[model samples]
Target: MGKAAERFVVEGLVEQTPAGPRLIGSRCRGCGTTYFPQKASCPNPACTDKAPVAALLPDQGTLYSYTVQRYQPPPLFRMDGWEPYLLGLVDMGDGLQVMGMLTGVKEQEVRIGMTLQLVTEPLYCDDDGTAVLTYKFTPAGTAL
Candidate 1:
């Protein structure tokens, strides 16, 4: 068997650049608020300018919090290796906190406020041999 062709879990959610993978988001022109998964308009009630533009989120952040998933998720969610994993809420600055799977560190070793870098890994391989990729957070400096 060879390496499988890769595809993101959702299109337009992430992009590959010369630097690395970047999350596609939106920045509100009114209040300068940023959002992940990209929003079509600013949700802030105080802002008058509802226009939002596409933006790439930072690839690094601080681990604000985390939790362990001891049980397998619903059938809609698939993983190649079914095992308990850590989920983290990462603060990417500018008041943006994104939740994603934690990688490259054990649960006992994970620490709040630790630096983390954005990464993508295969969640599962489809029957057609496509590796479904999803964004994750790993300890900074960990080799990809």
Candidate 2:
């Protein structure tokens, strides 16, 4: 019934997709401006003439770049202790890009231009003990 309550009800990785399983985003048909997670505003001032339109994010893309955070990102995360992890940005063929955790990795291994997949992670727990979540990209395929 409350914000916190509502968030908890819908918390966790939404394996299911309303519009579709593929990522969804918005592209300003006016100025070609793009937004991730979708938005209701045209970020481009030139395109501000009208409300930002809704669009589905492209599912297929190449790994533009990647890196491993040896240090914990901080309080916003909960994984027992700080674990050096991998993170990466996926360049959806649609010109829109997304950042996500780099799963399917081998210790001390990372490469750019690799394929990726979206995986959700728990952000933190609310006072009511509800766990917040976020999506991250992980490297695809089993590690050698």
Q: How many backbone collisions does model 2 have?
A: 8
Worst 10 residues of 2 by lDDT: 5-14
Superposition error at 20 for model 1 (Å)? 0.5
Q: Which stretches of candidate 1 lie over 4 Å from their true place?
A: 1-3
Cα lDDT over the full model 1:
0.93
Candidate 2 lDDT over 1-144, as tens digits, reads 225522322422243364324555667777777777667777666664645566666544577877778887665456534577776778887577777666667545666777766544455566776655556565655322
Task: Give per-residue lDDT, candidate 1, residue 68.
Answer: 99
User: How would you encode candidate 1's per-residue C-alpha lDDT over 74-121 as one tens digit per residue?
Assistant: 999999979999999999999999999999999999999999999988
Model 2 TM-score, 2 decimals = 0.65
lDDT scores of the candidates, listed in order: 0.93, 0.60
